[model samples]
Target: MISAYACGPGDEPEAAAGWAFALAASTFCDVVVVTRRRFEGAISSALAARPELAQSLRVIYLDRHPALVALKRGQAGIYWYYVLWQRSLRRLVSRLHEQLPFDVVHHVTFANDWLPCGLVGATSAPLVWGPVGGASASPVRLARWLGVRGSITELVREAITRPLRRLWGDRAAREASVVVAQNHDVARRFAPVTAHAVVEANASILSDDLAAGAASSAAPNLVGPRRAVFVGRLISWKGARIAIAAMADLQDWTFDIYGEGYDRGYLERQVRRLGITDRVRFRGHRPRTEVLAALAEADALVFPSMHDQAGWVAAEASALGCPVVCLPFGGPPVLADVNAHVVSLERDLPAALARTVAALPRGRGERSHRWDAGRLPRFLEQTYDRACATSAVAEERPGRRRVPRPARAQRR
Candidate 1:
């Protein structure tokens, strides 16, 4: 059984994660997924093409109070809605399990480390929580300069999450047979509460044609780095401004930015102020294919995200054999593990980016893929086996979930 509060549409991060995780789990076992009712159409359409998954994968969409829907606009009360939904899910799953008799229960989405999981006492079956995140934070040095809007948003978010971390932190981790953290930071946060914490990225589809446009275009400029690309929302923490700042130093190089957001105006202004208007172009929200193609053709993917739990663009950039220049912190450092340059956060952000490009390794072989289909299934098998084994141990122990801490390297 999979509890993915957000599922389908294949767009929102949580929904994408839920859909990917549930799909992967279904490959190993029959999956009964519980998700929000709004996603029914997208999920149904996705399942339609894959008739094989029709029988093995069943989705249950649960709707929330009509008032909650109103509050969810602009994420005003989305947290409130999710909290109430999770509380209600406990009851739904308890009744569902009496009829279905699930062997293992998994809570797969809304990948926030602090968000409470409802599956804690819903069933006796082994529980798999997370591959979740939300522990990452924007660099204090960079965040302060993002003007009033960005600064306040980060401040307000941190303010809210700090206390909730102490409150819901234990409940989300302790009861699980396995707590699959999306990154090292998330794993560390749960370590104090549960011995089952392990670092594993949320599974994503590995395209069969990863080699389709894997070839890197030759650097056209003789003077400096030729070209760079960035794909993702143009939010303050996403570091699009930093990427644009870097373009100032790469005089001959061109930087193309995809995607639009509240920060687009700010980023564009920074570009003009940097006096790199000719080189830095904002291509606001392009198709994924166009973005991927641009990635293939670019010299580097400068994704300097401040606090990404699972930098999916970094993974995609790496898959296309593009060099990734990202921060030493957060999910980008892990996902952009090869053909990549990790630069430290400094006041002179542009210089760091320039130095990274100069230091980039070229003519590299195929990089490691964390989400390869063959690899993820094998990993899941081990995780399930481990969860069941530990669950058996917990059953014998009763009233306590204890196991030796995983070795340091394994912890990551």
Candidate 2:
């Protein structure tokens, strides 16, 4: 497993996904995980807590070049460092493969499809890329809702990343044995590249947590107006402002905004401008445990994010049996429970949100759905088995192009 940005105890989505996937993979097979040096302490501590699991896992930490390390000060620097890291990883994996000659090489982190997976071409082992994404762009029609600066930033980002997307698509199609897209939009992007792709929600929630959340939902405790909570970074794309805008007409309901980002000041000002500061609370950033606790108490998870590949909170909210109100588009629809509300963005968002909020049940109810963490390991194992089988057939066929396997059937 090559996961450059894998986290150990970190709360970042990428880190959590990497850590959970790596741990899960270790349970099924002897796994070699390559990650950055920064997570060494956390990884060591976590492994120490599970000595039996550690016996089957080998972790290798790779440090970036000093020049690249200094580049962490800016976004460009971080990207450049990632590019350098990929180059370094190719060399590292080539050497590792010579010794171990592993069955598969899975690229797990920096899940964006725009970034090329270095280990794919470096090793003959069947390569699995993703649950990868980054194809979704903020809807141009919703530009005004994002404000002037936010709109420009989104546009600029699209322009700069266009070339990278092309390169990534071409590389993934030619080299990746399996491409796991996080949502339909991303799957469409890779359609031109290769048919060997599948849509799987990347977020992984523990079965125990889901059980606890489900149990919590059966009991109701409410005294005041129903509360709607918004989790995720406070960015225009995350639709925090949209939630605030929606709150203007929802005078009977209180809203809480968690997580912090560059959009904090703008969102704060919008709250003041709307004169609903008293009804809304900016709780800032909180630990994952605390965030889950907050979701348990809330009546609904108001996730208005426009382009999220898969918001983990939506799954968490569903597991807790908390109602979720999200945009009909993107990854949220896939993760949200069947009973959760999905407001259409074709008309006025605030009006749609208002209607959705008004229609939501005032009291807590059992979650109709919950994420099954057990499925992750099974699904990944199935994917690995498929990749290996396909790779063997390709080798036997020599020059013939292998037929793309049916994706949905493999999931079962």
Candidate 3:
């Protein structure tokens, strides 16, 4: 059986849970989720969302001292705790290393790019990681296409960062026997260098049992008029604020802002100051299942994510037949082909939103439901089998040490 590790919240958990659910039900594999003390609740909460798959998951919550929890909760010292507090992490990794058995340690991170390859090097098992680093080719291309001439300084900065990005990937990716890229865009970046790099888009939604809750044949007409829903953290570059400002002139439309972050209070204040308090609603963080359900009920998923690579929300919404109003952030070339109403922040956002809203066809006809559990497991199983096969072949090769298959961690 293959073993995987899920660290932190966000897409990491979504991908991990989906893979685990698939692995458990179809392939003979198991997943153990490891998280800091504070995020233990998040793991349980994630598992509770899918009761059918809960039995297959084994959750391990590391309860360090209370001081660590407090430090993690506070925004100020998080960096210090994450990197500087090496002793704590070493103790935690040592303890986990001893307790759980992972043949292939998979760290599903926001940007697999940030971590050092040496991180899991201490372990005996081979590591398969990625979607690494948060980058989108679309946005950069979009930025260039717009002809907003970058100053010499900006060009110099890019030149410097370009090499650094490569170095970062080389250092982190060189250590992994297998590196998975969720989108073709990301896969292309590593295609030239890493022979092990594989493109594997998220295969989670195939198992969601949406058919059980059969609804009327009539289109899901959300009671509210021409509503746009944007789900994500309320941060500056996220471009949700741009969506809000864009919808400002559209008197008939309402924007429901879900999810929370450092800018919650600031965004709330901006909504009121802009006199859009009545038009824009801040429905701070909801459960992930509820969030998806809510997306299904909306007219369009308005995602103006500027910094993110592939907006999973867009994919989820699109899968549900919910049209997406997006500002291209790059990655996932599939979005261009999927049912999406494209917009750009580089251009006049408000005008673009106004045009998109006015031009939108009344309702989506027959779009696939965002997530279905059954198909995803089969896909993941194939990937796992392929990875194992590759390992076996490498073992057969002359002068190469074969990677051991992961041992299942005992359930807690």
Name the top TM-score candidate: 2
Please give, for residues 290-376, the per-residue lDDT of candidate 3 as tens digits: 676766667777776654555567666776677777664454234423667777454666677667765766676247543344455
lDDT of 2 at 300: 84
Model 3 lowest lDDT segment of ten:
209-218
Model 2 stretches with alpha carbons more than 4 Å out: 207-223, 368-370, 398-412
Q: Local error of candidate 1 at 309, Å?
A: 0.9
**How many clashes show up per model?**
2, 1, 17
Which candidate tops lDDT?
Answer: 2
Per-residue error for 366 in candidate 2, Å, reads 4.0
Worst-scoring 10-residue span by lDDT in model 1? 403-412
lDDT to native, each model? 0.76, 0.78, 0.56
Off by over 4 Å in 3: 1-27, 30-70, 75-103, 109-111, 117-119, 123-126, 137-168, 201-219, 222-225, 248-252, 261-278, 284-293, 331-337, 344-346, 392-412
TM-score of 2: 0.90
- Model 1 alpha-carbon drift over 4 Å, by segment: 9-13, 208-225, 361-367, 398-412
- Which candidate order results from sorting by TM-score in descending order? 2, 1, 3
Error of 2 at 263 (Å): 2.5
